[model samples]
Target: MTLDPEDSKLITLARAARARNGSAEGAAVRDETGRTYSATDVTLSSLTLSAVQVAVAMAVSSGARSLEAAALVSEGDPGSADEEVARELGAGALLVAGPDGTPRS
Candidate 1:
């Protein structure tokens, strides 16, 4: 599945976060799994919507059993803009899983 516009916004903010933090690379916190994953840390080459789908699929098929209890950004910090993205995306529940293995909250 493709990421919704809200998700796109969130990703943009994430990239911005990396830029602000002066890190060329940073992890996208997976709310579902409370895991920090890099765009290229696994098989994902791009941060596109399609990549998110693939990542989520891989995570589930690879024995990740319970993402419901996980947090989306366990490491890097998300700015208010990012938080807004999440809010707009209705990802504040920590119960909804995104296609990229990130929690909706």
Candidate 2:
């Protein structure tokens, strides 16, 4: 499927994050101003966060008041928390892609 250039960029960042970190999931988000943040899942003994959740946190911490879009690259679907966080931040859509960077959801 054809994707907008910016959206495609998000997927590329997410895919790279996954590959670089050897993580199960990766995610990227674009803020209202077009700034983007990317992250991999965080799995620690005391804390765990989805890739999308981490990406949202990065955007928020960077002073982004709202989000434009989000992209998640994973073998499985994004969890409800991931979707909710993005929505709460005013993201228009949380696009989903397979590990291979193929759009799936």
Candidate 3:
């Protein structure tokens, strides 16, 4: 399937985060204001957070009250929590892309 340019940009950011941190997953989200936030999986011994969760948290902490879209780039699929959080933030799109940055159906 084809991806919107904005969504593609999210995938690019997510992919870069994954590569930069050598994490298993990376995620990016766009807020209602069109601002974007990106994060990688946090796997510290005392803390474990999905990339999606971290990205959402970043947006919220940055004063984003709602989100427009989200993208996850990983070998694995996004967990239910990822979808739930996006939904709660009013995200219209929760895109999942492969590690190679290919959108999943």
Clashes of each: 8, 0, 0
For candidate 2, lDDT tens digit of each residue in 1-105?
A: 888899999999999999999999999999999999999999999999999989999999999999999999999988888889989988866899998889986
Residue pairs with backbone overlap in model 2: none
Candidate 2 weakest ten by summed lDDT: 85-94
Q: What is the C-alpha local distance difference test score of each model?
A: 0.37, 0.93, 0.94
Off by over 4 Å in 2: none
- lDDT by residue (5-42, candidate 3, tens digit) is 99899999999999999999999999999999999999
Ranking by lDDT: 3, 2, 1
The digit string of per-residue lDDT tens for model 1 on 1-105 reads 366554544455444444555443323324354443323112336643322232344445556543322123223333454344334423353223323445444
Provide TM-scores for the models.
Answer: 0.26, 0.96, 0.96
Better of 1 and 3 by TM-score: 3
RMSD of each: 12.1, 0.8, 0.8
The number of the candidate with the highest lDDT is 3
